[model samples]
Target: MELISSDKRNQLFERFAHDAFHLELRDDYSVPNEVGPFEDWLNGRESDDSFMAPWLQLMKRVTESGKTVRRVRVVTEPHSPYIQWEHATTNVNEEAGELIRWLPRHKLPAGLHFPVDGNDWWLFDDKLLAVGHFDDGGRVLGSEIIDAPEIVAECIRVRDLLWSIATPTNEYQL
Candidate 1:
């Protein structure tokens, strides 16, 4: 698998034609840029989300261009601290034009299987997938693209199903 730059992975958002969808399965993400923000949250500080400005800007630009951006996060009922922080800060994403939803693990239909390598991913335009790789400590290790029709199709199916069942951000509190 080839490791692609995070910038390139994010660049797909600008180039996609119809819709962009992301599936988040992890309980934690120890991204370097987020470390400080997470720490602030843990210390009872409000999330400024300044670090997310660039991506938020892109989301606004793309959505304003008539494209769609959505994400579904499958989280445990008693979410991890990271997820709590993410949930607390999700308004920023929504305000910037990304629609996010959450699904509790227990609410997921039994026997459901995720597509591809079973990691978190972004499926763009129903043609390409960018899957994230992580270490045991939850730090990101970049991502790679998959364009095979069978794999992409399965991912699309999984995405649609999860999105259908996820609770919209506004409908959820916590």
Candidate 2:
């Protein structure tokens, strides 16, 4: 299957109406742009978050127009270092109008099965899906765009189920 580059997938942000939701199941993401920031955070040094500027700007625009961006992060606790950093920084995303929630992996309902081969995905308006593909080193490859009715429907169901139980970022404690 053909996969679109992350840049291309992000363009969906410009087109999607209503809501865009992301499911993050990984404890670490080795995004190249994040390498410096992550390392700085790990070393207890001040870190610059300018790398997130573009995405934050986009989310700000999207939410300002009445569209919503949300994410459910299924994490394993005690949180990984990266997750801890993410938890600390999530307020920035929220400030840009993205609603984020966290759910411990152990808290997922029994028998719940993730769709799209258990890969992370972004669902737009409950109609389109951009399923993330990653290399073995935890780096992103790209995303496969899937709009098949059955697949999108399954993702929507999962999004709803997880969203219902996940704790809003503000209420979650380390």
In model 1, pairs of residues that clash are none
> Candidate 2: lDDT of 97?
97
Candidate of highest TM-score: 2
Best by lDDT: 2
Give the per-residue Cα lDDT of candidate 1 at 55. 90
State the lDDT of candidate 1 residue by residue for 63-88, as single tens digits: 99999999999998788899999998
List runs of model 2 lying over 4 Å from the truth.
none
Decoy 1 TM-score against native: 0.96
RMSD of 2: 0.7
Tell me the whole-model lDDT of each prediction, alpha carbons only.
0.89, 0.95
> For model 2, which pairs clash?
none
TM-score per model over all chains: 0.96, 0.98
What TM-score would candidate 2 get against the native?
Answer: 0.98
